[model samples]
Target: MTRYRTTDGKEDMKQKVHWFGAAAIPLAFMNGLFFGGYALRKIRQYWEGGPMD
Candidate 1:
């Protein structure tokens, strides 16, 4: 494994935080969208009076 090192500790921390936010925001948004879509589908099925399986 390769270790990434930076000369400035604060900068390293900032970079890590930035990277985390960049990755996490899109992941969370996609997850929310997936669940939201499922919820909407279930709602539509209920509206149609269909048996959920």
Candidate 2:
């Protein structure tokens, strides 16, 4: 047996962003930059046929 969730039209669906949520934008950006650089380095190594170390 499986249960399903149903939402009524009368349910409140408002969303609010707290002050801390705004701070995550910069953190997410920095994370993206860090990972992007790491990925680029790996890609360069692959192009050069070098071992991933």
Candidate 3:
């Protein structure tokens, strides 16, 4: 079996985030907030294509 390291596995996400394909910022933001931010965390998760995104 082949095992992937952190550096080896982040390329896909790095490219996605770097390209700013419209879904990156929102998903990142929601993830960050939900993980450790404010009450709006839940709200952010559902606010796709929103102004903040």
Candidate 4:
């Protein structure tokens, strides 16, 4: 495993927090949509014996 070290620790953390904040919402939404669709497809497959792959 590799460790990432930054000279400006506080600034680095702040920047990382900002990036995460900006990305979290869309990422969460997309993940939810993708998993929801996947679950629905799986349910359909289980009930109707539809092809899932």
Candidate 5:
């Protein structure tokens, strides 16, 4: 689903920022800082590591 991006695509990025921003901020606060930070770290780890254990 590569966009090829023949047009200006800032709106798409902004849209995503808005969506995830809505969920991630308060959700992270609810979960507390340590767990929230660790979860984000693990997500980045998995992203780089091809989802392997």
Candidate 6:
């Protein structure tokens, strides 16, 4: 397999990765927070011997 090198392609890929990282960082953080809160809520319910909603 032969791969061609081009500055344009490299720059495009870099830009895409940069954009993805910018979006992904906050998204990942929010996802963690959402799940963490959900877990805590479930834990509290279990500790209280209440029904899970």
Query: In terms of lDDT, which candidate is strongest?
Result: 2
Candidate 5: minimum summed lDDT over ten consecutive residues — where?
A: 9-18
Residue-level error in angstroms, candidate 3, position 11: 27
Candidate 6 at residue 25, lDDT?
A: 79
Stronger candidate by lDDT (3 vs 6): 6
lDDT of each: 0.73, 0.75, 0.57, 0.73, 0.64, 0.73
Model 3, span 1-53: residue lDDT tens: 22234655653322222345566779898998777765565568667545463
lDDT of 1 by residue, 1-53 (tens): 22346777433433334566568879999999999999998998999899666
TM-score of 2: 0.55
Give the count of colliding residue pairs in each prediction: 0, 0, 0, 0, 0, 0
Q: Summarize candidate 4's per-residue lDDT along 3-43 as a digit string, tens digits.
A: 34477653333323356667889999999999999999899
Report the error of model 5 at residue 22, Å: 28
Q: Candidate 2 lDDT, tens digit per residue, 1-53?
A: 22333486453445455556677889899999999999999999999899767
User: Candidate 6, which ten residues in sequence have the lowest lDDT sum?
Assistant: 10-19
Least lDDT summed over 10 consecutive residues: which range in candidate 2? 1-10
Model 3 CA RMSD to the hidden true structure, in angstroms: 14.0
lDDT pick, better of 3 and 4: 4
Ranking according to lDDT, highest score first: 2, 4, 6, 1, 5, 3
